[model samples]
Target: MNIKNTTSIFVDCHVFDSGFQGTRTYIQGLYSELIIKRDLHFFLVSSNPDNLASIFGNHSNVTYLKYKYENKYLRLLIDIPQIIKKHKIDFAHFQYTVSPFKRCRYIVTTHDILFINFPEYFSFFSKIINTFLYKQSAKWSEIRLTVSEFSKQKIHQHFGFSNYEITPNAIDNVFFEDYDKVLIKNEVAQKFSLKKYIIYVSRWEPRKNHQMVLKAFLDLELYKEYELLFLGNDTLSNPQYNEIFSQVDSEIKKKIFTLKNTDFNTMLLLLRGADASVYPSMAEGFGIPPLESVAAKIPTICSDKTAMSDFSFFEDYYFDPHNQIDFNDKLQKILKENLGTDFKIMAQKIKEKYSWKKSVEIVYRLIKQNQ
Candidate 1:
């Protein structure tokens, strides 16, 4: 388990971005921790050179390798083997579900098996590629890591891989640190002109069940004084998202604000200042935003389904994702309650359970053990 002399570990860094969502945040946090701890020399192979540089710039131990491919199959079949051989990588880790080359020892983080469960949401070609790649990756990987017990079970049931490890995804420690709450609240309120607001941070996809949130918000007469902020980009890449955005009622749309391309600090300020954070998704691998809200001492409402229930910090705060009436009733109760005591207690508990340093330490241990 000697990791000190390991030459380098190549990472599939396609998800490295600055938007502060789940996958990008996971990779960025892990990369930052590894660089600081000197766990191993790291190299990122990705199609987006700009994102690689944006995320890893000025880190001495990290290097970026440009990977160009017209499709995932081409990357899997052609480019990856060349990069591994040329760089002499001791091990390779894929952030996504699939890995391209299998020559060296490999570890993969399976965030969730969404594609396997919801094939209709993906194209026929994409579904095929994802299914094949996941099965192959599970069969070949020296170690497998998943974010939650729910996801671990799903992976085992679907791919029949029994040797996988669990490393729960966590929030950055910086989010849990003390900040000038009054100042941040004032600044965010002024910037967004937000008087009273509830926040939902996720991509506007069908599975996210944003329409349910929207419907619940519209049903609440109490929400007339408060704005519903949807803080994530809405790329037209998902047809369902496009149709939902297009068909939203004019009155509801007026009360709704969609903010795209927000940075981590701004998002932290917003979450910290909000009255409550709501996420009623139909599915999730491991819901990170609600975890972040818990860390930030914001009252959070999330679906009682999938890995969302596995987050131990917010045990009493889940609602049915399909029951808009129930959601609205809960929202009303949250709006009326004094959340300070409960928020502080939950925030402290979350700080203990979910930390990037702990996550990286587990990952490093797993890698060293396999090495």
Candidate 2:
């Protein structure tokens, strides 16, 4: 490795606090691979530098910088540029659609343009903020990257930038760590009162299409055979919560579970032990949990919409997200299928397609090419 062309790469790690699953995984996976490269230096910027350090450990090539302010605008506009210049960064990776300053040469990862396609899901203020920042970020970025072909097309259609790259999201190989099913099942049963369960891993938000998923699961009578686990934080503020719960029978409600802030290891155990995984999201830049489930060797059923179609097993596995009948049918197929062994084979193939090692190499080459 030639040290002559080594560049200082600044990564906006603030997405760590956003609690958005896809963005968090995208950054962590890439960073984990990048940190091992001897030819580059990293400056990780986050609100919680200690926590970031704790996750990545003390890499000699990595430096962690804490952003003290809680206000996103102030931190991005003033603090971020100052930090970049202070460290004399050659390039930076903004993990999301926007970067605070345009003075430095940097790459921006625009996860998706969901706001443009699904305006009803976003507030007016959020739409405004994202619209402005997304356009500016697209214009300024040296290389724009997205998580899927669906997201890349969305960005091109909405932002009119055609030169972007598709850097698909991938699971941490940690999910593939082997576990003893009998012991893990016994432990999970005691901890979460587990039953024969199908897992749905995503935030409890409307865009995740939780209502449709719950309806489809109940309509198919799948709840009688298997518990429906909704993994993520409570969405008490979401109106759909009351509407969906109101329809649930008191007895059936016991079979529906929601676990928020679950530890990663425990979540992996849950996935491993699950009978199957269900993801009927309305839209996505790229769906991670479905792929994660497949990687965990848990049979998965996903919506046919958006980036879920990109999954290698999707042709046989996807259903119409908006149609409860189609969802119920897909759920039934997943319940009856004994394709776990085949999916495990597909999982290994899928794993090859989405290595963080490959993704970081693209980023490194992009940085080098631009220089």
Q: Pick the candidate with the highest TM-score.
A: 2
Estimate, for each residue in 290-337, the C-alpha lDDT of model 1 and write its tens digit: 878877777787788888877655666778887877788777777889
lDDT of each: 0.76, 0.81
- Which candidate achieves the best lDDT against the true structure? 2
lDDT of 1: 0.76
State the lDDT of candidate 2 residue by residue for 1-371, as single tens digits: 33235688888888676554888889888889888887798889899898898878898788899997778878887888888778878887886655556667878998888888988877888889888888888788888888888988888888789989887787888777676878877888998899689888988767888887677667777777889888876532457756878878999999888888876677788888798888988888888898888887788888888777777566778888888888887778878977867777878887888888888888878887998
Reference-based TM-score, model 1 = 0.88
After superposition, the stretches of candidate 1 with alpha carbons farther than 4 Å from their true spots are 1-5, 17-20, 37-39, 47-57, 69-74, 97-99, 118-126, 235-252
Tell me the spans in candidate 2 whose CA falls farther than 4 Å from its real position: 1-6, 18-20, 234-237
- Model 2 clash pairs? none
Clash number for each model: 0, 0
